[model samples]
Each structure stands twice: as C-alpha cells, then as structure tokens.
Target chain A: MKTYLPPKSTLIVWQIRVTVLLALLVAVLYWFIADYFLVLFCVSLVLAVVFNLIYFPAFLRCYSISVNQNAIIIKSGVFIKHERILPFPRMIYAEKQQTLVAKAFSVSALVLRVARAATLTVELKDNDIAEIMKAVAKWQ
Target chain B: MAVKLKITAHPIMIFYYLKPFWFVLIIPLIKAIVSAVIKAEVNNVLLNELFISVVLITYSVIKWKKLKINISSDFIEIYLGVVRRRYANIPINKISTIETTKSPLDYIFGTQKVKINTEAGKQGSADFWFKLNVGDVKKVTELYPEKVTPKTIKFSAVRVAVMAATSSSAFTGIVLVVPIINQAVRLLGTAVTDLLLDRINKIGQLFSKFMPPVVNTVTVVFLISYFIAFLISFFKSVNFKVVFAGKKTGVFSGLLVLRKVLFNTKSVNSVCIEQTPLMRFFARYLLRVGIGGYGNRKGDRAVVVPSAKRDEVHELFSVLFPKFEPADNKIKPHKNTRWRFYYLPTLFLAVSVILYLVLSYSFPVFKGLISFGFIVTACVLAYYYSLAEYNTKHSCISVAPVIYANYTRWSATREMFCEHNRIGIIHITRWPVDKRKNTCNVRLTVRSEAAESITVKHISYNELTDEIKSLYQI
Candidate 1:
C-alpha cells in the first residue's frame, strides 16, 4: 500500500467537487418549488446518510490496495452490495488521473479495460498508472 | 417459360398511392389545433402543411416513375429512387424467395403490390414500389417469358389442396377482416351485454363482483381472439404458386398483393424454418426463409409459408433447397453438433429460475410462471441435451459466411455457418464456472457490425480449439 500510494491529482478533486455541486444543485431546486420544507429536509438527510454509507468504508477498503498481478478488488455498497474485481490481464489501456480533494487525501484510483478502456478510469498517481500502462501494453 | 414483365402504374392506382398523403394532411390539422389553442396566426401553419404535402406528393410521383422494374428470362431489374439513381439487376436464377403483399390500398382497389426478394447481392431489396392490379400482377408474371421450364412436374395435389383451402375466397375475406373482426367482437360483447344484462354501467361492476367467472369468460374470449388471428395468418400464408423456369424462380402468392419475385439460385445465402410452441402443439407451423436481400425490415424480406402440418416442413423444403433432407427419425446425439449447443442454455435456465425464486416476492405471478417453466423445461431439455451431447461426440460444423438456425419456442437457439476464412476477429469466452468446465463460447466478427456476434455455444475448449485450429486456422 505504501509503495503504490497515489500522488493525488488536481482532476480527482475537480471531479469530486463537480459531483457534489451537481448534487447540491438538485437539492436547491427542491428547496424552491417544494410545497413543504419537511420533504426537502428529509431528502437531504437521507442523501448524506446514503453517501457516507457508500463512500466511507468503501474508500478505506479500496484506497489502500496494490497488486503485482491479477486485479484490484473494490468493495462497495450498503444494501445492494457489490465487489468489482478488475483484472490486469484484461487491461487493454490505462490512464493516470488526479483531483484536488484526492490530492488533499493523497490518494487516487486506476481504471483498466480490454474493450472500452475509456470507461475504466483508474484513479492513481500519474507515475503508477504510467508504469501499469507500460506493463499492460506489452501483451498487445 | 418466362414471359417478359414491364410494370407501369395505372393512372387510377395513383389514388391508392396517396396513403402517405393522409399523414401529410394530419400535419395541418395538428398545426391548426395548436395555433388555435395558442391564439397564433394560422396562415403560416396552413401554408407549411400545403408546402410539405406538395413536396411529399412530388417525391412520391418521382419514385413511381423512376422505379423501372422488369422480369425476363434473363433477370429482374429494378431502377429506383429520385436523386440516388440506384439500379439493381438480379438474374432470375439467384432468387431465394419472392413475397408480395396487398396493403389495404390494394385490397380496396382490387390491386396488388409486389415485393420481390432475391438472394446474395444487395440488389434484391424490395422498395415500396410500383403497383400491380390483380390482372397486372398476373401480367407481370407473363413478363418472365421463357419456355419449357426446368422439367415440369405436377406439384403434389395434397399441396395444392392445402394451399387452396387455406386461401379460398371466404378464408381470404375473413383473414383480411381481422382488425374488423376484433372490433366486431368487442362491439358484439358490448351489444349483447347491453341488451341482456346491463341497462346502465354494468360490465366492469359485474366482473369486479363475479371475479373468477368474469376472468374465465374474458380468458376464453381472448383465446378465441388469438385463434382467430392465427387462422387469418394461416389463410393469408396459403395459395402460394412457386414456378421454376430457365434461370428464374418466382413465387406468386399473398392475399393482398399477389407478388412475383425472381432471382438466381447461386445467390441464396441461407434458409431455415421455425416451429412455434403453438404450432408444435397443433402440428401446424409457419415457414420463414431468410434470403440475401434488403429483407432488413420486419416482415417484408422473409417469406412466411404458414400453417404447414408437422414435418410437412418437408413439403416446403422441396421448393427451397430440394437437395438436402434430414432423416425423418430422431437424430442420434452423436450425429450432429446440435447436442453440444444445448447445455449452456439449460444451465442458464436453472440459474435464472433460482434468481427468480429469490426475487419472486416482488412479483409473485411472474415468479411463479418463470420458475414453473424454467424448472420443468430446463430439467427435461438438460437431460435430452446431455444424452444428445454424450451420444454425439465432437462433430465438425459446416462454415457459412452467414449462418441461421430454426426458431424454437421454448428457447432462443440459432445455428450459424460463418465461413472461418472470412471471419475478421474471434472471441473465445468462458465464465468463471465455465473456465473450470473447459467450454468455450465462440463469437465471430462481421465487417459491418461494431463487435463480434455469438456464433455458437457450449463446445469443450479442447474440441473448440482443435476445430479452430484444423478448419478455421491453417
């Protein structure tokens, strides 16, 4: 985990901020048109609770992982739980990413795929992803 | 003998072509309603509809004129479209199947429309084309003027009788009246209930009160309604006339548009027949042939020879391929690769049944039917498939550039014979469970598609690798 720990990128923080902003925008829309503030208040509480439930433990379990071979196992979800075991063998492509919040946290993720590599956004230190990409592309 | 065909739109038939105009008129009515509701000026909206209708009518007329189609001893040629000026010439011998339809336009006007599908080349695409009346349809047939066709033999009388009975005048009229029949049934039910039981709002109330009895009655009515549609489909599918002459093979059939399609034999890509569960139950089935033509749309390209009794598929097959006949008796599992394809589907069913039972509380009725059918059919099919696979050891499959399978009711099973030489990319898939099992799900790519398509399923990895090595690879 220490050897592979990511140098958090500016992009990760940007993305997190963008997502949060979009969520708050939706929250604010409800605040204006809603006949009752009670429903809005209730919805916001539920959102915060759900978000915390999804991210806190999941981020902890996943953010500390490194693998020499095989796949990264991301454990997530509260009620409808899932484990995404992504194999390096299926890695057709890869990229490095960063965000401000992730930089603050000193963490990142990596996305890898065989077909649609664009969809597998692996958030990690730019150097780690560069090393991973060089190794994976050798198969092709 | 084929008589030459020169098709020209009858001046009177132009009125029949105006069906699209109905839509053209609808634009204005909608515009007027919107304009009135919003209190906007109506003139611009009215002018737009007028301008649009003129453009549509002009385009239709141009399409009618440029569509130069002719069937001769040599070939069938169709020149189509206004700006593109695309022309397709399919030699008579390349014809796989020809289908003609009679839209309500032709039905009312006593005219018929033709959609001819030939095999191999892209040229055999059917256009919403030039009109032919009943006599004109027959005249179009005469255009294929050639003499002493490939050995005239009287087609079986039983076949003729079946065709005639299916498409007899009364049968056709009733078949043609299906939508009306449905309307009539609804009307009759309302009329009878109104006169006998209900003086006021009563049908729904009665049904809600006498729930089971009402449910049974409605079920019976719906079943009959479905049967009526089936009967109509059967009738419409009959009365086919297949002609094999010098270079041309043509089919003259259809209730509405008596059609003739001619193409060469070499162009035929593939042919298959399917039996629905209902068809299997009643021993009556529909025969669909996919030819190499623009039959890309839903029903236009496939010829539906409906209501053939079981194994009576042999009757139509004679017209289609006439060369190969599968032995009548049940095949030994070892004889073909069909058995190898059965296991994955069976396992899939078992897994799905388990999933549904787990989820059934959300939808009890859906869950019941799913688990019921899955548990029952999956067990039986799995057993048969096991026997078939065990009995028939690794058998080589024929390669087609394109392959098709007979449609079955209980499951989705397609057979393909894609030419290994032409396949651009290949995928060998195995799920987590399948990896231990050592079975490969083979998928092959086509040029036009974005990704590879599943060509076949459930062959042992060893057998699959060997087959790919020996046949597909050098």
Candidate 2:
C-alpha cells in the first residue's frame, strides 16, 4: 500500500489566490458601505483571511490517498472525516484537470470516476498522479 | 450481409431547428400584423423582423440540407453543422436505446423523431436526435436481426389518472407556467396584469365569505397549479404500455405526441418500487427500472407499472426482471439505534418552539397566526416521524452472493433490487458517536442515469464488513 499527500507548494498558491479574491471583495464593499462601518468591515476581512490561511494547512494535513492492490481509499473532509473506498474493478474513468494556479505549482486535480455521476476528485502532484495512474492500470 | 445507406432527416426538421427562436419569430409577426390592421401601414420594426426572419429561415434550410446520416454495417455516422462541419460515428452494437417519438408536425407529415442513445454519452440527454420518415424508421429497426413477439401490458385510464395526480406536484406545474406568465406580462403591459389581479382578488373575497379565511388567493393558486401538473402528467402517461420480448423491453406512451423506446433488458441496473406519501394512502406503488441511457432526469423514469398493488408489482417483477426478484433473507438495523429516527422530529420541534418565542417577542401583531402555523407544522412532522420509524422497522436489506436489495421508508418508501455488477461504490461512514456505538452507515451507490444511493444506517460494524466481503469477494 502507498499513501500520497499533496505537496506544500499548493498551499502557497491557494493562499495567494484567496488573498487576491478577498482584496477585490473588500474594495467593492468599501465603495458601497458607509464610512462609519469601514473599521468593522476591515476587522472582519482580516479575521476571514486569517481563518482561510489556517484552514488550508489543516485541510492538507487531513487529506490523503492510499492505494492498495485491489482498491484505493481516500480520506478527506475538514470537520467530519470522510473515507471513500474506490475499487479498481469498479472504476470506469480517470480524468486529470489543472487550474491556472495548480498548473503553476505542478499540481493537478485527479478525478477517479465510477459509472454514472460518482466521482472522487483530489489534488496531487504530477509524479504522484503518474504513480496512481500506473497502479490503476495494473489493477484494472 | 453488409449494409450501406446515406439518408437525410424529414424536411419537417426545419420546424424543430427554429423552435428555440419561437418568441423572436412570433412576437414580431404578431406586432406587424396588428399594426398593419390598426394603422393601415407597416413600420421599421416590421421590416427589421422580416429581414431577421428570412436570415433565420435560410440558416435552418442550409442546416437541414447539410445534416446527413450514413449507416454502415458496423457503425452509424452523422454529419452535422453548416458553418463548421463535424461528424459523429457511433458503433451499432454500442447503442443502448433507440427512442422514437412524434411532435404535432411530425405526426402530420408521417415522420418520427428518433433519438439514438448510448450509456457512454452525457447524462440527461440523448446522444443523437433527428427526424426520420416512417419507412426509414422501419429500415433502421431492421438493423437488428434478432426478433421476438413481445407480451404487452396496458394501463387503464382510471389508474393512469390516479397515478398522474399522485405523482404530480404544484412546483412542477408552477415551473411550467412561470415563464409563459412572465412573457404574457411583458407583452401585455401593466393594465392587463392589474385587471387579472383584480379578478383573482374578487375570487379570494368570495372564498373568505364562504369557506375558511385560510383558503386565500395563494391557496387557490397552488391548487390550480397542482391541477395543471396533474393534467400534464396525465397526457404524458396516456396509453402507457410495456412490452417484454426475450432480452429486450419496449415502452410506448404519450397521447398526442406518441413515443416508443426500445432497450435491452440486460442493461437494466436497478428495479425500484416506490410509494410517495399520497400513494401510501391508496396502497399503491410505482415500479420503475434504471437503465444506462434512460430516466436520467426528473419525470423521465422508465415506469413499468404506474400504480399497482404489492402483489401486482411482485407479479410483474417475475416476468419483467426475474433476475432481480426480491430476496427473502433480511438484515435489520441494530435495535439499540432505533431512537435515531425520532432525532430529526425532536430537532424540528425544538426549532419551532425557539422560533415561536422569538417571533412573539419581536412581532406581537402576527403572534397568534405564527404560533398556530408553527404548532401545526411541528405536529405534522412528529406524526410523519412516527410513520417513518414504523416503516423503517419493517424495512431491511436483503443480500445474496450476487444480488443486493434494500427496502427503506422515510417521507417515501423506496425498495431497490439489483445485481452485483450495478453496484458502483460503497461508502462506510463512522463518526465519533457512531464509533462509540460500534456501528456505521453504509451508503451503496448504483450505476444508472443518476447516481442513486441506498443508505443503511446504524448497522453493526463487523456484521456490515462480513456482508460486504461475502457479496463482493474483496
């Protein structure tokens, strides 16, 4: 059995993206709302950014993929720990998609899909994806 | 023998090609005609509409001319698009369902609109849709050599009507009319809408004068919507018939616009027997099958029996899907966890009490009505919870080496029977509280039009593991 975790570089890319989005939202809200409540809004924005930064690392720590000879088990979810078992024989398709930020960090989202609409999507580095794909091909 | 034929759809395809722009075409034409009759002259808007209409018609003609189907021995190729040409080649054996239907125009012209579907295509839509002449439809059917005379089952008009009424909801009916109502309001202006509102208010006044004050305009509107939904469903389900031919099954339905769908029985994933709250009152169940390329969307279920008794459903199951017949062995939930059923209703009651107190404090004007509504809702939910608990006690999961069957009753009772191959993924969820109890929730998903899941809650951890291991041999 092999366990794979997402690389640390993805976290930096995610934080940067979230920060930029938050900055844009703050700018928009600033123009519309009253000046009296600006201080409160700024404080709330700071807290939101702080919370987001902390959440990514905790989430990355919790998420993991374990591949065995016959099946792959994925552990995810932030508050309620979710474990999904995907057997190689039942899997029909595997798709790899990369967002702009993920591409820059050499990370991609791998979607392991069974029949119909049941799919498990996870982010992993290119090397990890190749290894998982190889295991999937060997088993299936 | 090798077969090769090149053909085009019926010329009536042009009507469907222009269906998307119906409002654009009709609105301008009506305006022009009315203006000409009233003012004795056509304006710039009429000329602009004429130009646009000509361009749209020309485009449709070119598209119809370009669309061609090439049928070979092994595959069917479709050449599509006028501006940028592209063709799709589908192997004959890979096709799952060949659905034939007729719109009003197609019926008039003796043409059938055919949809070729495959399991591998996108969900909720057919892979290919085109029109074919009656003779061409017969020719297409000839591509499959195997033939057998099928046994037919027909539904009675009364049963169909009852089933339609039970299955229909006010939301669906409102969805159908909301867009048309919006269009009417936009075109007719505010004076017409105000007059309509006045008439509705007058009706509401009469209702308040005679019946209870609760039966207001809103309730009347809801009842009207529900009736419309029932009518739509009734029309769609009229003349519903099911045919079983060895390894194939065919469904024929629709009143004005006739439809015929043929699919292989081997491809069927799950056979579901369901009863909504309303159906429960009549002691009836709606039996449907889940196939790869059919019933992917809401209201499109491949119904085997619309409204039938328990024995009738079981009898039909033996003939229609003998492989997925209900099993006898049952696995009940852990008895200690039965209290979980009352958890939801308790929560609702608690929320209702909190809301009543808060509203009474904030809004003294509407206190009496708010309290009455909340109490009624909470009571109904509690009663429903009791019913669900009783039903769940009777429900159980039946599993053999190669087949899995689940029976569950909540707001609706759903029983699903399927073979092992249809099972896609199994998820075992265990929380902190569940771990303490040494039990877990096992959710089993099946391969169908949509990923339908059957969840067995509060089952012993070791028992579930053993059952899964024996079933899947993992």
Q: Pick the candidate with the highest DockQ.
A: 2
Tell me what TM-score chain B of candidate 2 gets against the true chain B. 0.81
Per-residue C-alpha lDDT of model 2 across residues A1-140, encoded as one tens digit per residue:
99999888767767767777767777777777757457856775786677567788888888999999889899987899999999876664454556667667877666675544445455688789868866764553
Q: lDDT score, residue B124, model 1?
A: 26
In angstroms and one decimal each, the interface RMSD of every candidate reads 20.8, 8.6
Question: Which residue runs does candidate 2 get wrong by more than 4 Å?
Answer: A1-140, B25-56, B72-74, B142-146, B170-215, B326-329, B350-368, B399-403, B407-410
Worst 10 residues of 1 chain B by lDDT: B326-335
Query: Model 2 over residues B1-474: C-alpha lDDT tens digits?
Result: 244777899888888899888787856677787878898987777878878888988999998998888887766767666654444455555566778997687767989989877665568787678988988988877765567786899999877876786666644345434444443333333333344456797754554444433334444566587777778788888899998888878888899888898887866878888877667778998888777766446722588798999999878877777777656666767788767757777888888888889987886645555665575577678667866576457656665644554556456778888787677888999989789998887788876667777877777788778877887788
Query: What DockQ does each candidate score versus the true complex, computed on alpha carbons?
Result: 0.01, 0.04
Off by over 4 Å in 1: A1-140, B1-7, B23-98, B102-111, B116-128, B133-221, B255-263, B279-288, B294-427, B432-438, B443-456, B469-474
Score candidate 1 by lDDT: 0.49
Q: RMSDs, each prediction?
A: 17.9, 12.7
Q: Which candidate wins on lDDT?
A: 2
Alpha-carbon DockQ of candidate 1: 0.01
Worst ten in a row by lDDT for model 1 chain A: A113-122
* lDDT score of residue B445 within candidate 1: 56
**In angstroms, how far off is B423's CA in candidate 2?**
2.1
Q: RMSD in Å for candidate 2, one decimal?
A: 12.7
Candidate chain B TM-scores, in order: 0.56, 0.81
